[model samples]
Target: MSEVVTRTERPAQRPVHRPVFLTRRRTYLWAAGAVLLLALPFYLDRFWLQAGLFAMAAAIGATGLNLLTGATGQLSMGHAFFLAVGAYGYCVFAGDGADGLTGLGLPTWLAAVLAVLVAGVAGGVFSPIAGRLRGAYLGIATLALIFIGQHVLFNARDLTGGYNGRDVPPLSLFGLTFDDRELVVAAVPFGSAEKLWYAGLVLLLAGGLFARGVLRGRPGRAMNAIRDHRVAAGVIGVPVARYRAAVFVLSSMYAGLAGVLLALVFQRTVPEYFGMTLSLDYLAMIVIGGLGSVSGAAIGAAFVSLLPQILTRYSDLLPLVSAPGTGGIAPGEAARYLYGAAVVAVVLFLPGGLVRITARRNRPTPQEDT
Candidate 1:
């Protein structure tokens, strides 16, 4: 006999669309942030403005490093090498050449572009190493870059000004010298602080946007594929070597851009600044901020750069700390201990880094709804 007729009704489904109010809320938040940034220089002193600039620079550098180590699954412990290339590159092209080695006398803007390009070349040269290397070996290979960069800086006496280091020329835009700490900008009463704030904001925006673009588009897919399995990606017709090298090169360029801004803000380029410690510090930031995430890198940069100031300010209050050249544990020493502990805690507890922590908190649990 045929089966008896017994039919079940299917449930209707609704298409998923984001709430309009949610979009509006995000838009409003972004507008508010922009307004706050624009008004910051007016209310802040030069010191505050400078701090903001430094934070932005570090964020940019961290963003690039994050792309390589976090996203591309490559471990690079020598990103500072690229930063050094950028700073020295700018100093060479725009600095006053007392010894006549560099000082091409090019416009600061042009010099900045060239510096970024040179940094890209440096990355390209290192790309093969990244493509062929992995794990501890990759870290060691990249580490060599720091020493190599330092040697070049020290020995390029004609260009780098040896030992003492050389001064960075003030950045000029269409005739306006961005160097003036006292100068005010248009529509802002406190011009100098405003100008610097705006400059930093612009660069940060550019860097963030570029990173977002890379991670959201086709290149991002390639990066993820290679990161997941280089051999498998190659088998599937992915240009693993080319993509790896390109990421390395692009990441280096980002580091260079960061270096150019850093030199401009500090008004000097010293070979000693781009040491192995700087590279390690950046790695710490990536670890603390969250690997493979741009937002995490930014948060990491702020923490790494700003924590020292807070620690120094409060070191006197701590029982084990004292000022340098006067008595107990040096202020710097105490700060280092604090930073080291923080790093250890972060790694031991949150291996995925700060991004995951934030994500976890933001996610809605059944308990949360209740």
Candidate 2:
């Protein structure tokens, strides 16, 4: 018996304890950002509030597009079509027939819900085409939706109010109405923009969280598989066509919700606003922000949507960028050119869009202590 009793094995190394400050850094940042956003309405003017609301709506729409085009590799050039459906659908559902337009006289909340569902149905109607097509083929097929939607919107005078569009009924829920009723809180008069600010924030947060969950789950994996390799994914038992169709429907619903929010913000729906140009703008947002990511879509939406507003606000101070109808380039046009260049730059150099910058900064260093 060599010493009969074996020495108890000790751990290979001491357990490492991360610093509390280091561990809580993300929580602190999130808290600070939340506090800042919540406090903005108190300090900012109506213009800024409205701009923020627009960004939120754009983020919602862009996130959906990212899911279809970015995550699932399905190209859609008719996102604006679904958005129009949602906007006009809400108007029709909640109009009360008082404005000389067709309406169902439904509650505003119900109208909003129904609008989203209608958009989903629209997507479902075209899902077969989506299932059969890919790349530019799918894009062209979807492009047809934009033309069809435009025709319907302009021709259906009763339901859509023709080219003039229709007024969006203010939402009433939980005894709180989101309108320009001038509710005062802490001495600040809460107008429609102010009231809708919180609602927009809530919607954006919920949509982002839901999208993130989808991306982190099985559906996301399936979408990615289809995106990366359709044939391989099929071989692995993933239903490529079904996933494509489902994602399309999901994306359309997102666009619908965003359209509803935008209608609320604008107080009126306009057919001209939801056009091919609008669809292109959404594609630019996902490209600039980083595709297949909620944060990416949001960041891109803010960048694209806010640039024009910022330029317009400071047109007098900025060189070569002037107010609309001025001698020089208009802020809107200039903003578009700038972001268009950004898209090219991202594709050539960054390849991951704006979100990659944050991801890189947050990534851990291999040399760091465990």
- Consecutive 10-residue window with the lowest summed lDDT within model 1: 361-370
Q: Largest lDDT belongs to which candidate?
A: 2
lDDT of 2 by residue, 1-370 (tens): 5767678888698555544555588679999999999999999999999999999999999999999999999999999999998888899998899989998999899999999999999999999989999999999999998999889988989998888888889999889888889999999999899889999999999999999999999999999999999999999999999999999999999999999999999999888899999999999999999989899999999999999999999999999988777799999999999999999999999888999998776655544445
| lDDT agreement of model 1 with the native | 0.83
Ten residues in sequence with the least summed lDDT for candidate 2: 361-370
TM-score of each: 0.89, 0.94
Candidate 1: tens digits of C-alpha lDDT, residues 1-370: 8998689878996554545555576679889988998887767776677777888999999999989988888999899999999998998888667655678888888999999999999999889889899879999999999999899999988888788788888777876677665564464554444565677788889998999889989888788888888888889888988888998998899899999989988887888999998898888888889888888898888888777666566777878776777678886566567667778988899888877876675455544344
lDDT of each: 0.83, 0.93
**TM match of model 2 to true structure:** 0.94
Q: What are the clash counts of all predictions, listed in order?
A: 3, 0
